[model samples]
Target: MLLILLGVLVLHLIILVLLLVSTAANAWTIGSTGSTDLWYKCLTTNGGYHCLPASNEDWIQAVQALMVLSVLFCFFSLIAFLYQLFRLVKGGRFFFTAVFQILASLFVMCGAIIYTVMSPDRDVSSSFGYAYVLAWVAFPLSLISGLIYIILRKRE
Candidate 1:
C-alpha cells in the first residue's frame, strides 16, 4: 500500500514538472529562421538570436491562460492528494484530487489543440518543437493520474 501511494505521488510530480516545462519553454514551433512559443517569437539572425513578445492574438492569450490554469489545478491536486492521504477515511476516494487533475488534463488538451489549429505559421520548413510534444504527453499522464486517484481508496 505504501509503495503504491509512493508511486502515485511520483507520477503526479512528474506530470506537474512536465506541465511546468511545457508551459514555460519557448520552443513550441521551430523553423529555419527561428522559433515561436506561447510567450516569445525568437528569430535567428547574423549568428545571433532576437526575441520578441508573442503576438497579442486572443487565441494565444487563451492558450496562455489555459496553460497557466492547468498548472495551478495540477498543483492544487497534488496538495489535495497529500492532505487526503492523512485525513481521508479508509474507504474514501480522492475525488477532489481526481477532479482537479482531470480538469488540468482537459485544460492542457484544449490549449494544445487550439495552438495546433489556430497557429498561422504553417511554413513547410518549420516543425513542432519538443515543448509542444511535452504538452501532449502531459495531457495523457495527467489524465491517467486523475483516473488512478478516482480508482484509489485509502487502506489502513
Candidate 2:
C-alpha cells in the first residue's frame, strides 16, 4: 500500500512537470507557429485566417513567471509529502505538511485557472490540441493528490 501511494505520488509529480513544460511551451507559442501555418492554409473560416501573431517576449516572460511559481510549489509539495510519508506520526508535523501540500496544489490550480481565463484566444494557437487537454488533466491530478494527503493516515 505504501509503495502504491508512492507510485501515485510520483505519477502526480510527473504530470505536474508535464503541465509546467506544456505551459512554458504554450507561453512561448512554440509549436503554435507551425500550427498557425497549417491552420492558415487548411482552415479558413468566417473568422479570417487563423494565424498566430508574432511572439511577444513580454507576455511569454510573464506567463513563464507564473509557470515557474507553480512548478516551485508543486516541487515543494512533493518533497513535503514524501517527508511526511516517512515521518508519519500523530503530531503537528503531519498536519503542517499536509496543509502545505494542499495549499501548493491550490496555488497551482489557481495559477492555471487564471492563465486560462485571462489568456487571449490567439494565445491558444490552434483551437484544438493535446496541450489544452493536458492542462485540464494536471488540474484534477493535483487536486486529488492534495485530497489524498488530507485523508492519509500514518499506519504505524
Candidate 3:
C-alpha cells in the first residue's frame, strides 16, 4: 500500500512537471530559422536572434489561458491530495484530487487541440516542436493519474 501511494505521488509529480515544461518552454512551433511558443516568436537573423510577442488571435489567447489553468489546477490537486492523505480515514477515496486532475487533463487537451487547428499557417516551413508533443504526452499521463486517484483508497 505504501509503495502504491508513493508511485501515485510520483506520477502526479511527473505530470505536473511535464505540464509546466510544456506550457513554459518556447518551442511549440519550430522552423529552420527559429521557433515559436505561446508567449513569443523567436527568429534567428544574420547575426543575432530577434523575438516578438505572440499573435493577438483570440484562440491563441484562449489556449494560453487554458494551459496556465491546467498547471494551476494540477498543482492544487497535488496539494489537496497530500492534505487528504493525512486527514482522511482508511478507505476514503481521493475524489477531489481526481476531479482536479481530470479537469487539468481536459484543459491540456483543449489547449493543444485549439493550437493545432487555429494556429496561423503563415509559418508554412515550421513544424510542431518538442514542447507541443510534451503537452500531448502529459494529457494521457494526467488522465491516467486521475483515474488511479479515483480508484485508490486510503489504507493503514
Candidate 4:
C-alpha cells in the first residue's frame, strides 16, 4: 500500500511538471527560422531572434486560457490528494482529486485540439514542437492518474 501510494504521488508530480512546461515554454510550433507559442511568436532575424506578442486571434486566446486552467486544476488536485490522504476515512476514495484531475486532462485535450486545428497552415516546413507534444502526452497520463484516484481506497 505504501509503495502504491508513493507511485501515485510521483506520477502526479510528473504530470504537474509536464503541464507547467507545456504551458510556459515557447515552442509549440517550430520551423527552420522561427518558433511560435501561446505567448509569443519568435523569428530569427539577421543575427538575432525577434519575438512579438502572440496574435490576438480568439483561438489562441482560448488555448492560452485552457492551458492555464489545466495547470491550476492539476495543482489543486494534487493538494486535494495530499489532504485526503491524511484526513479521509480508511475506506474513502479520492473523489475530489479524481474529478479535478479529470478536468485538467480534458482542458489539456481541448487546448491541444484547438491549437492543432487553428494554427497557421501556410508553413509547410513547420512542425509541432516538443512543448506541444508534451501537452498531448500529459493529457492521457493525467486521465489515467485520475482513474487511479477514483479506484484507490484508503487503507492502513
Candidate RMSDs in Å, in order, are 0.7, 6.6, 1.1, 0.8
1-156 per-residue lDDT for model 3 (tens digits): 999999999999999999999999999999988988999999899979999999898998999999999999999999999999999898999999999999999999999999999877437788999999999999999999999999999999
**How much does candidate 2 score in TM-score?**
0.62
Model 2, residue 8: C-alpha shift (Å):
3.4
User: For residues 60-146, what per-residue lDDT tens digits would candidate 4 score against the true structure?
Assistant: 999999999999999999999999999999999999999999999999999999999999833879999999999999999999999
Show model 3 residue runs off by greater than 4 Å: 121-124
lDDT of 1: 0.97
| Counted clashes in each candidate structure | 0, 0, 0, 0
lDDT digits (tens) for residues 1-156 of candidate 1: 999999999999999999999999989999999999999999999999999999999999999999999999999999999999999998999999999999999999999999999999869999999999999999999999999999999999
**Local lDDT at 109 for model 1:** 98
Better of 2 and 4 by lDDT: 4
Clashing pairs in 2: none
For residues 98-132, what per-residue lDDT tens digits would candidate 2 score against the true structure? 56555555655665565455444444444534555
Model 2: lDDT of residue 87: 74
Between which residue pairs do clashes occur in model 4? none
Residue 24, candidate 3: how far off, in angstroms?
0.6
Supply candidate 4's per-residue lDDT for 53: 96
Off by over 4 Å in 2: 26-62, 90-94, 121-125
- Runs of candidate 1 with Cα error greater than 4 angstroms are none
